[model samples]
Target: MNARSLTLRNVNKSYDGVHMAADDVSLDIKAGEFVSFLGPSGSGKTTTLMMIAGFQHPTSGEIRLGERAIDNLPPHKRNIGMVFQNYALFPHMTIADNVAFPLRMRGVSKPEKERRSREALAKVGLQGFEKRIPSELSGGQQQRVALARALVFEPDIILLDEPLGALDKALREHMQVELKRIHKDLGVTMVYVTHDQTEAMTMSDRIAVFNQGRIEQIGTPDEIYFAPKTRFVASFIGDSNIIEASALGDGRFETAVGVVEARATGAERNSRADLLLRPEMIRIADAAQPDRRPFKIDTTINYGDNLLVIGKLGTQAIRMRVPGVDARRLTGSSECHVTWRSEDIHVIA
Candidate 1:
C-alpha cells in the first residue's frame, strides 16, 4: 500500500460554538510514520482523530491527506481504514466473509476478495480460522478479525481508537507486540488513539500528548519523558517529583533539597519555578556525607521488582523508587541519606 501523510491545519471544533473541543490544533504526520495521540478523557485527542477520519466535521480549519484537501469529504469518500475498541464485527457472518466485507462493498470479484481477505488474516496471525464465527473466537481473535477487515481494503491510512482497551493485561501486551510487527511489515501510516501512556511510549515512533483541547508536547519517548515542556506533561506521563524552587542564576536553583543544580531551560534568574525530578533518578547516598540530605521514610510500597518509598526530604514531601534489593536497608529505619545528579533535574517554570 502507498503511504500518505496526514496534516491538520488550525482545526477547531465546538459543540455550542463557544468552548473549543479542539482548539486550533495543527500537526503534520509524515508518511509511513507511527504516531500516537495520547491524552486523558475529554482532552480533544479523540475529537481531533474523529475529524481526521471524517466522523465529525471540523468547525474550522483544513485537513488533508497528502496534498489533497479532505476537509469536506465524507467518511466513505476518504477511503481510510478504522478499527474501534468494541471490534464491531458482524456476529452472524463467517470470519472470512467479515474480513472481505470491505472488498465486497467495492465490487471486487469473489476470488479477489477471498485472496485479499486470506492475506490480511495471515498478516495478523489469524490464518486457518476463516470458517470460524465471531462467537467461536476469543476477544483477541475477534480484534484480529477487525484489523484484517480494516486492512483487506488497502486503504490510504489506518486509525485505531483504543483498540486494545477491551483486552486483559497479558492479552493487551501481546497485541501491542503484534500491532508493532504488522506496522513494520506493511509500513502503513498508523494514527493510534490511546489514553495509556505506556502503550504510546512502547509502540509509537512519535507521540503527540494532548491536554485541554490542545497538544501539550510532541516528541520521541525520551524527549517527552526527560524534557517535558509543561508541568502537566511532567506529572501525567510518569512518576514525577514536582518541587518548588527559586532560580539562583547560573543554572542553580534554591529548592527544598537546598540550592540544587539543574538544567535551567525553563527557569529565569531570580524567578520561582518548579523542578521535575523523576523517582528513579534519585538514589541512596553514603552515610556521613555532609552535603547529603536525609529522606524520612513514611511509607514503602513493593512493586515486585522495585520499591516506591514515600518520604519527606527536609519537610518537602517526595517519592523515590529504589531496587527491591534495597528494601532491606529501609526495613526498620525511618531515615536514609539520598542524593541525585544535577543533570537529571529538569526545570519547569
Candidate 2:
C-alpha cells in the first residue's frame, strides 16, 4: 500500500455556532503510522474523524491528504476507507459479495472483483468464509468482513470508528492483536477513534488525547502514560493518585502527609502543584526508610497475579499495586509503609 500522510490544520466544528465541538485542532499524521484518537464521549475524537472522512466538514481549516486539500470533498470522493461501529455490512449479500461491493462500486470487472475480494478476506484471516451471509457469522467474523471491505479498495488510509466496540471483551482483545498484525503487514495509515485507553495504548504508535473538543496531548503511549502534561490526561489514561501539594524546591513537595521527595517538572518554588503517582510505582517499604510514609491498610483486592492495596496516608486515600507474593507479606497486618522513587512521581504544574 502506498500510504500518504494526513494533515488537519486548525480544524473547528461548532454545532450552535457558539460552542465548538472541535476547537482549533491541528494535527499531522505520518504516512503508514497507526494513531488512535482517544477520549471520552463528546470529547471531539469522533467529530474530528468525521471531518477527516468528509462525513462532517470542519467549520474552519484545511483537511489535507498528502499535498491535496480534501476538506471540500465528499466522503466517497476522498478515497478513504471507513469502518463504522456497526460494521455496516449488507444483510442480503454473502460475505464475498459484501467485500466485493467496493470494487463493484468502482466499476471493476467480475473476475477482478472476485480475485481482489478473496485476497482482502485472506488479508484479514477470513479466507474460506466467503459464501456465508452476515447474520450467519459471529460478531467478530462480521467485523473482519467489514474491515476486509474497507481494505478491498486499497485506499491510502482507513478510518475505524469504534469498530470493535460490539464484540465481547475476550474477542475485543483478540481483535486488537489481529488489527495490529494487519496494520504492520499492510503498512497502511490508520486513524482509529475509541474511548478505550487500553485499546489505544496497545495498538497505537502515538496517541492523540482529546478532551472538550480539543487535543490535550499527542505522544507515545509511554510518554502519555508516564509524564502527562495535564492532570486530566494523567487521570484519564490510567490509574493515578493525584496529590495536591506545594513545591519546596530541590525536588521536594510539602503535602498533607509530609514533605515528600519527588522530581518537580515545572513547579516553581513555593507554588501549588499536583503530583501524579502510579499505583504500580509505589512499593511496600520499611517505615524508617527515607521518603517512606506510614500507610493504614483499609482494603485489599487480589487479582490472582497482582493485588491492589487501597489505604490512607494521613487524610488522603492512596492506592498501591503489588505482586501476589508481596500481598502475602501484608496479610494479617493492618498497617505498613509505602515508598516510591523520586523519578516515578510526575509533577504537574
Candidate 3:
C-alpha cells in the first residue's frame, strides 16, 4: 500500500497559560518514510505524537495529511493506526478476533475479515497461534498481537508510542529488528516515539531530538551522533568529553590538556570555546616514542569488550576507550603518551 506524507506547520500547545507541550514545531514526514520523535520525559515527544494521532489538539497549528487538513479530524476519521506502550489487547478475545475487530467495525464481509486477520497474524509471526488468548502469550507475543491488530486496518500511517518500552532488553532488541522489517516490507509511513537513544538510532530514517518543547536537531543517525548542531544535542546523543578552552586566534586554542589546533568556524579569537572529543578518538601510546607527548595513566577500568583508560595531562583528567585486546598490555600508574588527530576535535563556541 502507498503511504501519504504528513506535515505539521507551526504547531504549539499550552495549558493554563503555561507551555506544557510542543512549541512552534514544524516538521514534514515524507511518504513511506520512518521518523522518530526522541527525547527524555517531559520533553514534549509524547505530546507531539498525541497531537498527530488526533487524541490531543494543538493549541495553534495546522496538521496536514497530503494537503488535507486533519487537525480537526477525529482520531478514527484520521485513518491512523496506533500501538500503545501497553499491549491494550482484549483479554477475553482470541488473537484473530482482536486483529479482525477493526475490519469488523468497518463492516467488512465475514470472509474478507477472516482472511485479513490471518494474513496480518502471519505478518507478525503469529499465524498458527490465532486462537490463543492474550493471557496465554508472553509479553512479546502480546505486543505482536497488538501490532498485527494495528496493521490489519491498513491505515495511512502508523504511530508507535513507546510500544516496546515494556519489554525486557533482549526482547526489546528483537522487537526493534522485527518492527524495522515490517516497516520495510509494508513501506508504510511510521512515526515512532521513544526516549531510548539506541532504539531511535537503530530504527528511524531520521530522528527529531526534542528538548524543552522544541526540536534541537533532526537528521540521520550518523549526522545526529557525529555532527550535533547544539550543546544539548551533543550531550544527549552520546558520551562526549567537552573541554573548555580559550581561542588563541587562527583556528587555535589553549585547552586544559594543552594548546591544540581546532576548527574555528564561528568563534571569535580570544573568546571562550568548548571542544568535544569522542573517547575513541583519543589514543594512548608508549612513552618511549620520542615524538609522543607525555601523559600519565591514572586508572583503568575493564568493561569486558573495552577498557576505559583515564589519565592526567597537564592537570586535566581525560578518558579514552581502548580495545580489550590491547588493554591487557597497559597497567595503572604507567606513563603513556596521549595523541589525537586535529580533525577529531569538534570545536564549539
Q: Find the candidate with the highest lDDT and give its number.
A: 2
- lDDT digits (tens) for residues 149-202 of candidate 3: 989988889999999999999999999999999999999999999999999999
Root-mean-square deviation of every model: 1.2, 1.2, 1.9
Q: Rate the local accuracy (lDDT) of all candidates.
A: 0.92, 0.93, 0.88
Question: Model 2 — TM-score against the truth?
Answer: 0.98
TM per candidate comes to 0.98, 0.98, 0.94
> What tens digits encode model 1's per-residue C-alpha lDDT throughout 198-243?
9999999999999989999999989999989899999999999999
Q: lDDT per residue, candidate 2, 241-322, as tens digits?
A: 9999988888889997788778745567899988999999989997568767789999998899999999899988998899
Q: Candidate 2 — what's its lDDT?
A: 0.93
**lDDT at residue 189 of model 2 (Cα atoms):** 97
Model 1, 19: alpha-carbon shift in Å? Answer: 1.4
Task: Count backbone overlaps in model 2.
Answer: 0
Q: RMSD in angstroms, candidate 1?
A: 1.2
| TM-score of decoy 1 | 0.98
**Residue-level error in angstroms, candidate 3, position 242:** 0.9
Which stretches of candidate 2 lie above 4 Å from their native place? 264-266
Cα-based lDDT at residue 161, candidate 2:
100
